[model samples]
Target: MRGWGGTGCPGFANLDKAEPLKRGVQCPLANETRVFRISDPETGATCRYAAVPSSHTFSSAQQVCTSCFGGQLASIHNYHTNAEMQFWGGIEIKDTEFWIGGVIDYQNQAVNCHWADGSSWNYAHWQQGYPQHSGHACATFCVTDGLWRSASCAQQMPFVCEF
Candidate 1:
């Protein structure tokens, strides 16, 4: 058999052969059944999602995701690899930048973001002219553009919540 790296075949292995398993269907793995919910209050479309954890800076996104659908801010996963071109999160900034999840680590100091799932802020997608470090605080998602941008969390913008 060939290993994951596709290196040389194992000893006495049938590299070119294909093995077929029994035809009986099998149940999905427990972990694979995990689901996250998302909702759009404007359109009233409730959706179950399986997406990687993302970060955003909009209370409206969280409110819409939770109140309208039934999900909370997205959570971080250690094994996540597929890069999300864009998604929502829970980091907000306005007059005074502060994390919606309850902490203000990103400022003149450095990019310090965190999530409720205990994941570190290693990835982010900021909108044009974002992370503006000049007395700007709070974070949220912009519904018009559907991208994560820095804003006043207290300014009252729509947010996305994860399940």
Candidate 2:
């Protein structure tokens, strides 16, 4: 099994499956550009997310957000923010889950889990009976139930980015 971003997450062994987002030139919105932006009026933090048609490992996704977009992965701090992010991502009730900023510290024996942006881990919407026994867990927001679930960091999936 390969390591995820060389971080020792056994679950991220399938890093080869990860893919980068596609680049292209397309029509822009009238008098403006349409970007996936979600703003929380309460916290005054805005999140910009793009859905990469290609898949990427959790670590790879995080890197792309920081380097390419000048933002870390999107961190869901509260219910409103989570809802807005979901809406911006066009997440549907039956859609598959998408990666977020929450990640388990594999290097630290999975002892700590936190968002990439160092925000308060105050609110979590874990799926009922979650944070599974799965090793080196990474968080994914479920579009189906609008809840968060722990998944293997190695899994290839499109992710969102936030500044």
Question: Which pairs of residues collide in candidate 2?
Answer: 12-154
| Runs of candidate 1 exceeding 4 Å displacement | 1-71, 75-104, 133-136, 143-146
Distance from true position, residue 114, model 2, in Å?
0.6
Give the range of the ten consecutive residues with the poorest summed lDDT in model 2: 1-10
Q: Could you estimate the TM-score for every candidate?
A: 0.37, 0.68
Residue-by-residue lDDT tens digits, candidate 2, 110-130 = 446788777768788888877
Cα-based RMSD of candidate 2: 10.7
Off by over 4 Å in 2: 1-34, 91-95, 105-111
Tens-place lDDT digits, model 1, residues 57-115 = 45534443343223444532221210121232222212212133322346665755555
